[model samples]
Target: MRFVRLAADYPVTVFGLTFEKLLIIGVIAVFLLGPERLPHYAAMLGKFVRSVRDFANGAKDRMREEMGPEFDDVDWQKLDPRQYDPRRIIRDALSDADPFAEPATPVVARAAVNENSAYLQRKRKREALGAGDAAPFDSEAT
Candidate 1:
């Protein structure tokens, strides 16, 4: 039952090798391959890993370019799993308010109407007075 539980819950790790085991294998490889040959092999391995990484990066860049505007417009930083969910936050805020409720009868427009009327009256009076009449006269009587 215990083994079954381990197999069911953690199937992958159950058969995985540890770091110590990998170290032992590397030591054995060095012995078999010899110290001098090991450096050359290690260099070749490093080059192989670098080439594979470069190829992968190039492919990714090419794919992104080919996808054109669709992929290009995506904001990778916003899409990151670690970022907060904006939709959920907005939904929670909206749910707290009753949408069907009539918005407090919009503040009576009487105040604005009065202000508008006063403005119009002043504008009309200024227009009727004409620009010359609106000008100030000097007491010196030039």
Candidate 2:
């Protein structure tokens, strides 16, 4: 089965150019290049693209030759940059994880302090001092 990549998968897209944008670019190019020189530039662009494809194919062939036919058997997907994305990998792995699984212990335990008792004492003192139920005031804003 062919792996069809979804557009949403591309998190680092630039411009996110669509057909409308491409058409707008083409119109702008024609205006800047002018009708007289447009054909010439178009031909040149085609030639440049063709040369790039040829160069890429040549490089792949050279790599295969140097590495032997086993190079072609390499799992290209495993070497993909997305495979190294911690967030995406973790999300996929945990998508089907048991929701009822026991929680793991904290790596670094904090002191067993009774924070609620301390807070209650502070609240009582604030109330005895006629402080409002509102949060503590900050002079920074003023």
> Using lDDT as the measure, which candidate wins?
2
lDDT minimum window of 10 residues, candidate 2? 1-10
The lDDT for every candidate, in the order shown, is 0.70, 0.76
Q: For each candidate, what TM-score against the reference?
A: 0.36, 0.56
Query: Where does model 1 exceed 4 Å of error?
Result: 1-21, 72-142
lDDT tens string, model 1, 59-113?
9899888998788788876664544556646765777667555444336455445
Clashes, model 2: 0
* True-structure lDDT of candidate 1: 0.70
Clash pairs, model 2 backbone: none
What is candidate 2's lDDT per residue for 95-124, written digit by digit as tens?
786645644453886788675798888877
Task: Give the backbone clash total of model 1.
Answer: 0
Candidate 2 C-alpha error for residue 17, in Å: 7.2
> What is candidate 2's local distance difference test score?
0.76
